[model samples]
Target: MMLTIALPTGRVFSDAVEMIAGAGLPCDGLASPGRKLVIEAGEFRYILAKPSDVPLYVSYGTADLAFAGGDVLLESAMPVVELLDTGAGRCSVVVAGPRSQAERFRGHASELMGLKVATKYPRIADGHFSARGVQVDIIHLHGSIELAPKLGLSDCILDIVQTGSTLRANSLEVLEHVCDVSLRLVASRKSTALRWKEVQSVMNKISSHVKEKRP
Candidate 1:
């Protein structure tokens, strides 16, 4: 059976290319294709989409399998099956702000009610604060989340920080660690039922490689 897979096209892209090749599913076309979104390797069909959109492709059954971040999966709440944790692109979703307001958030997040927060993950941010019995005015921003508190657009921000350098450059400090994010292998239920053995074979191959890479 021909298996369709969706992958994001950024940080996880190169790593995925390498991982898939190591797993005996060499996508030579994907590795070398220029200006092409779709690449086919024998019975495997691969589509490159934005990281956030990969889950959507899998959820809609447009792609049989997908590699997505736990952060995006939580924010989007797509109902696709999270089959395995790949552990690539490890990072944390965090609440941050300029050092000026550091003391305030450090005490009690809920006390700062109506806090102005900026984030790309509104759902995640809302859920985090709501659980603490706090309400916030969430400012939705696609990028440069570190600048929100710098420019007075918000008191704090919720964003994924792979390294603290960006926050330091922006004079922000992490107030709380929301959750750790990593790539995970996901499969559509239709794909699981229709091509169970094929999917298992690929998953098994990759799973073994993942175990080898981890300490």
Candidate 2:
């Protein structure tokens, strides 16, 4: 039986491929897939997709297993089994704004009600603010989230930050840290139930490698 795995195709693609190859899976052309979206390696078939789309592929059974960021998984809210934390794509989901707005957020947070918050992860942003009993308008943008505050499109932004360099470069500062994110292994329900043995075998190998690499 063949196991179809979905690999995110962006910053963490190389890391995912390295982890799979380290787990003894063939990764001949994964590092430089170029235009090829699919690659077959013996019993394992790989599907390269956007990081945000991996969860959808696994949820719809297009791929049995996948690696996705915890933030993506949270925003997607797809019904898939989270198997393990691959410890890849480490970052933080944060709420940030310009220095002036940061001052208001810190000193008079209540007065900033209905402040516009821009982000790509609307679901995650909404949940975070809602949980905090704060109500703000969520402006969903596909890209260029940093520009929102500069253009006055939003007073703040709830997005992912890896090194704090982007925020610094944009003259923005983190007002709150929402959550830390990392790549996670997830599996479709159908695959987990029907291909239990195969899924378990692959999971065990990857899990072993994860443990070995952990410090």
Candidate 3:
């Protein structure tokens, strides 16, 4: 029997391939894509999927396993089993804006009021502000969240910070770090029960490879 795995496509795909290769499941076709989404390596079959859709594919059993970001897993709320944290694509979700406004917020005794905040993550933004007793108007944007504060669309922005260069380039200062984000491996519940031995073997291989590569 062949196991079908979904790998996220994009920047993280390279690391996923490295990990998969290190696990002894070298996907040559994926290593050098040629308009192919599906490929075969030994007894395992692989599917390339959008990062956000990987979890959904696995949850519905379209794919037995998937690689996705921890943030996507939390936001999607899919009922997939989180098997491992690959520890790559490290980043932080943060609240940031102009240094002047940030300084004022630090001195303010009252909860932030009547402020419009922009973010790609509405759930995270709502929860973060609510916890601080702040009432905010959330402006959801697909990209360029930093432009919100710069263009006066928002007083603050909630977004992922990888290198802090983008924030600095936009004159935004990080106010607080929300959470650390990383890539994670997830598997379907049915897959786990139906192919326990096979799944364990593959997982063990990948886990051991990860341990060996770590500094």
Candidate 4:
């Protein structure tokens, strides 16, 4: 029986492919898939998808397993079995805004009330602000969230920050940290149940490499 794995096709793609290869799995051509979305190597069939779509593919049983970032998983809220922290694509989800808003963000609860926030992660932004008892008007955007505040579209932005370079370039600064994000190995619930033996075998092999990488 062949094992199908979904790998995200962006910043974390190389890391995911490397992890699988290091685990003694065939991952040839994954790093350079070119225009192909599906790749086959030995007993493994790989599905290339957007990071945000990884969970959906796995949960729908289209792929038996996948590697995705914690941020994407949280935003999508798809039900998939999180198997391992692959320790790839490390970053943070944060609340950020213009430097001028920093003091206002820190001092005035009144200012925070019904604040205008822009983000690609609506669910995550809502959850974070709601948990803090702050009401916000969430403006969902596809990209360039950092421009929201400057463009007078939003008071702040909740987004993934890798090195703070983008934020700095946009004259934005992080006001609060939402969560640390990293690539995680996830499996389809049905696949885990029906193909436990094969799934467990792959898990064990990957786990060894994961353990070896840390400390």
Candidate 5:
């Protein structure tokens, strides 16, 4: 019985794999030198995918489980059962902009004059500013949202701030923290029902490992 897990491919991949290994799961495949997107370790088949696609894979039952950031869930809005907060890949969805614009935010309604905001997470950005009763012209970009403010494409950027280095380097400051993000283990409803014991065991191992790392 093989359990397929979707592993995000990128900087977070190594961290996520290490956490899985620490949970007593075989994760040797993650270290193999190859371009292979799929690898087998113990009873699990790990599939490397973009973080955004992990939830889709799990929701569609192509992968039984996955670990993704809470921000991804908010952006993708895929239906998946969140099993645990793995406490890895911590960051925040934040509204940021150039020094002047950041200060103008929420200070006066006058700043709303065709206010521009750039972000890859448009839905998240839209909902955030809307909830605050701030009307903004959200410019959607696939990457380099920080560049938007610097290039004058937008007044600010809504993006994931991991270390705040990107914002600082780009001469931007965080105006508001929309939400905190961390890696979360998710399983499809079908997987939960069909592999109840397996899923439960994996969840327990992961939960215990996370608890052990707590201060």
Candidate 6:
């Protein structure tokens, strides 16, 4: 029986397809043009989902497995087995703002009171700030969080920093690194029991391929 997997529809999709194929699994029909939500590869089937929604698909057993960023999993609070860290799409979650603001944040818990922070990941942002014993107003934006600080819309921004180019271009500097993020293979708990053998085989193949490709 072929397993169903959820593939994220974005820049990482091609690399994900390559990884799946490297693991000796069928990985065709991923390149079909325009809004084709589902496709088949030999006996295997796949559903293309938004990066953020992949966890939801797997959690509800709509898709047996998925590949997505560790950040997404962390923010979604979904219950699933993290089968493997694919190590691609590497980035870091960070707290960043103007250099002058960095000095104020240093050991100054009272200064953070009533400050506005902008981010796409509100949950992650809230947790980070709350842990620091600071009260924050979260401005949730879907894209271009770097603009928040520059526009004076937010005093700081918590976001994924890939190369820090965007931050530097906007005169923002990384204040602190929150967590390292990469693509992860995640599966429903039911998948572990129902498809253990197949899952293990796929993981083993991918693991070997990853080891072989390492420099």
Model 2 lDDT per residue over 174-211, tens place:
99899999999999999999998988988899999999
TM-score to native of every candidate shown: 0.96, 0.96, 0.93, 0.96, 0.94, 0.94
Model 5, span 35-150: residue lDDT tens:
99999888989999988899999999998989888888898989999999887889999988888875587677666657898998988988887887778898989988888888
Once all C-alphas are superposed, what RMSD does model 3 give against the true structure? Answer: 1.7
Report the C-alpha lDDT of model 3 over 1-215, residue by residue, as the tens digit. Answer: 78999998987898888989999875767798778999988788999988878989999988888888877786677899988998989888998999877765775525477778899888888887788787889998988998998899999898988899999999999987788989888899999989878888878888899899899
Model 4, runs deviating above 4 Å: 108-110
lDDT tens string, model 6, 1-215?
Answer: 77888989886887688788887787666766367888888877889899999999999988888888888998998998898898888899999999978877885789889988899999999988888888889999999999898889999899998899999999999987789999888888888889988777777777787777678
Candidate 4, residue 170: the lDDT equals 91
Off by over 4 Å in 2: 107-109
Q: Report the poorest 10 consecutive residues by lDDT, candidate 4.
A: 102-111
Give per-residue CA lDDT, model 4, range 12-77, as digits (tens).
Answer: 898988889889998888778999999999999999998888999998999999998999999999
The residue-by-residue lDDT of candidate 1 on 162-200, one tens digit each, is: 989999898888988899989899999888888889889
Number of clashes in every candidate structure? 0, 0, 0, 0, 0, 0
CA lDDT of 158 in candidate 1?
95
- The local lDDT score (0 to 100) that residue 193 gets in candidate 1 is 85
Return model 6's CA RMSD, one decimal: 1.5
Please state the error at residue 148 of candidate 5 in Å.
Answer: 0.8
Winner on TM-score between 1 and 5 is 1
Between candidates 2 and 5, the TM-score winner: 2
